[model samples]
Target chain A: MNILVCISHVPDTTAKINFTADGSALDPAGVQFVINPYDEFGLTKALHIKEAQGATITVLNVGGPETEPTLRKALAIGADQAVRINATPTDAITVAKSIKNHIQANAYDLIICGQESIDYNGQQVPAMLAALLDVPMVNACVGLTIDGSTATAKAEIDGGHATYTANLPMVIGGKKGLVEEKDLRIPNMRGIMTARTKPLSVEEGLSGSNTAAKAFRKPAAKSAVKMVAPDQVNELVRLLHEESKSI
Target chain B: MILVFVESWNNQFKKASFEAVSYARKWADMAGCSVKAVVSSGASNPESLAQYGADSIATLDLAATGPGMAGQLSTMMDGVQGVVVAGTAVGKTLAPTLAALIDGALSTNTTSTPSSVGPVVVERGAFSSKGIETIALSEGMPIVSFVPNAIGIEEKAGAGAIESGSASGTDKVAVSEVSVASGKVALPEAEVVVSAGRGLKGPENWGMIEELAEVLGAATACSKPVSDIGWRPHSEHVGQTGIQVNPNLYIAIGISGAIQHLAGVSASKTIVAINTDPEAPFFKAADYGIVGDAFDVVPRLIEELRAFKAAN
Candidate 1:
């Protein structure tokens, strides 16, 4: 079986988020970039399946030259090869189209991606890709197993969980617990050096996209925290009812 | 015409759907157009859609039509100027598909009403939660999905008409079976949540967390490590890669808050951290902090809550 994993290059979780002078784009001046944490689960799960079921994993990303370091990290981890659609992913549709272009040529048995990229948090890419490919897709997959030609997966729903069984050529958006963080295989020195020699294909991005971020601003600061003493339960209830009106 | 997809499960309109309807109604009123709600299940009560300001409700029987439900929804969007859906998982899937099918743009997770722009101008989160972005969709008949719990649900008096529709054929995708986890409240829908981490020691000690959650009418969640160690179900994991929740209250017990964990719950309205470690990073983000041992403090906290409840 051939598996494809989608990865995103994002600011390290610890990095301070700052805006540019004009506040139009993210200010990545001194921020450290890493593979999106959510995507790590996708890559790790694919590697586990590859090791257990003899499947090959190919990592894909849509970003510019800066994303190559993260792509190489994916290769070091366990991907057999990597593809970089050289483009600044502007919107969900453009990113989906880019992935679809690669998927059209290669018949992947399974495509796995993070539920959402930590950078943009635009959780639409996986569903959009599945729609473009016209294949069955599951989101927030927490557990997965393969039985012969069918793949059974458990997806985290709003209140409960839903189990889905789909044939080959299905897409899954992974959340936490799909694979343990300890199970992540970090490539050794040799693997890292050799990953540079592996295939790192790049293609032109689609143009003429209409969706663009017109302006960016910060959410208004939340009101000052009102401390209701532990003994003020009735007061809290009254405030919630009459003042906050939340109830 | 503007279309609103009123999401319902088990024959009840979700609170998020009410929020969506309120948004759709506001937009429709501004655009001088009629708003109609569509539901996938025929079992849904169409009358409830009117209370939230929908002018009409259309129930499409798609149990037989399978997973091409998006295509069917797109067919309904044929004459509509715009479509509004709750930015839940289902809407996340359907809205983009409908947009792609119509060759239009989709603005997802919008927080506010559109500006006076031609298509629509809306605000969406960008760069994690670091910033908000204002985007204008110029494409005709844009599809927009509002983030769940982002907008408040309001009610308006209305006597809307109900229409029934059916789609031919069966869904290509079939839900072979549903294995629902036995829990009092779903994590995503819970207004309050109590989560634990490695600070709780073993899975057996989870009784305290569960007790506190039960007292507060909140769902139980665990950090990634707890889920990784199989102490808690993966469905209960909350983090960057897990389910993001924005409940009214989030109580972190014994969890030395990690940034990944904070990312999931930061949207929560009030955060209360109870940990033995005073220097835990969660204290900086929490609205209330109690520096004490969980084993010693949790029981007392529960006792206090029970006593407080009885008095109230």
Candidate 2:
């Protein structure tokens, strides 16, 4: 079986997020970039499938050259090959369209992607890819298993979980529960050396107009906390009910 | 007409559905149009929607056929200028499918209402609510998914004309079983939430958290570490990689408030943190705070809340 994993490059979770001088874009001056945390879970799951089911995992990303390091990191983690779509992902539709075009040219039995990128948190690409490809897609999936042409997955719903079954040529938006932290493999010296020589391909993608961000702003700063002494707990309840009217 | 998709589960309108109707009403008023609500669960209270400014309600009986709510709603999108929906579990899947089907521009988890003029524009959280971006869509029609609680629910009386519709069925996927979390309020709809972290020490100590939540009628949540260790169900996890909640009040107990955890609760209107360590990062983001152990703080708070309620 052949598997495709889509990844994104985002700032580290601990990185302090700031805006540019004009407040139009993210201030990348001191932010440290890393593979999106959720995407790492996707890659880890893909590697598990590669190890257990003997499938070739190809990592894909839709971005410019700055994303190559992230893709190479996926290779080190255990993807058989890497492919970078030479485009700036301005919006979800553009990224999905380009991925759809690429997938149409290449065949894969299963497609995997993180539930949502940490940066945008849009959670659009996986569904859009499913729509454009005319395939079944499961979002917020925690467990995925493939057997021959049938795939059974468990996904989180409104109040509980629901199990779903779909045929091959499907998409899955994976989250943390897909694999535990201990299962995630880090790149060793040997794996790092091998990743440097692994096949990484770059290809052009389709062109399309998408929604543009006109401006950027920060959320209002939180106010100073009203601290109540530990002993005066009932005062807190009165304040919440009368002053805030929140309870 | 601005179409708002009202999501229902087990034949009732979710809280997000009311907020969606209210949000669409704002846009409709700005555009001098009307708001039409489309219900996907095949059952609805048109009166409830009418109170929230829905001019008409279209009920699609897709529950029996199963899993085609998006396809059915796509048929109703003809000539609709703008589409609105709640960012609920089902809406997360349905809106994108509908937008792709109609070749419309889609924006998810929008924090601000778009201006009612042409070339639809809105503000959405980017980088996990760390920054906000003002987006403009000039392509096909615009579809916006309002984050849960992004817009407050309000009542504006309207003529509640009800219409019934149906769509053809396809058995691509079947839901084998559903076990709804009964009795407890779901996190997304809860106005008040009490979430705990490792400071409580073990799963056995969850009684106090539940007691506090029970006293305040709030939902219970946990930090990623607590869930990761299996002390709490994954559904209770709220953070960057976990479920995102936007409640009116979020009380974090024993949580140090990692950035990832803050990313999820930052949208909450008021935050109160109770931690033994005074310097826990969560204090920086809280509206109210207490420096004490959960064992000492939670029980007392719960008792105080009960007393306050009795007095009222």
lDDT value, residue B153 of candidate 2 = 91
The residue ranges of model 1 lying beyond 4 angstroms of the native Cα positions read A147-149, A219-247, B63-67, B115-117, B168-170, B307-312
Worst 10-residue lDDT window, candidate 1 chain A: A224-233
Interface RMSD, Å, model 2: 1.3
Give the lowest summed-lDDT range of ten residues in model 2 chain B.
B60-69
| lDDT by residue for model 1 (A1-247), tens | 9999999999997666777778688888999998887789888988788778899889999999999999999998878899999888888787888899899989999999987888778777887788788887777777888776788888766666677787878888887667766776677998898898888888776755547778776655555444444443445445544564433
Give the clashing pairs for model 1.
Answer: A159-B186, B64-B170, B64-B171, B65-B170, B65-B171, B66-B171
Candidate No. with top TM-score: 2
lDDT for residue B274 in candidate 2, whole number 0-100: 94
Pairing residues by index, what is the TM-score of model 1?
Answer: 0.91
Instruction: Give the per-residue Cα lDDT of candidate 1 at B111.
Output: 69
Residue A117, model 1: lDDT of 85
Stretches of candidate 2 above 4 Å error? B63-67, B169-171
DockQ of 2: 0.75
lDDT of 1 at A52: 81
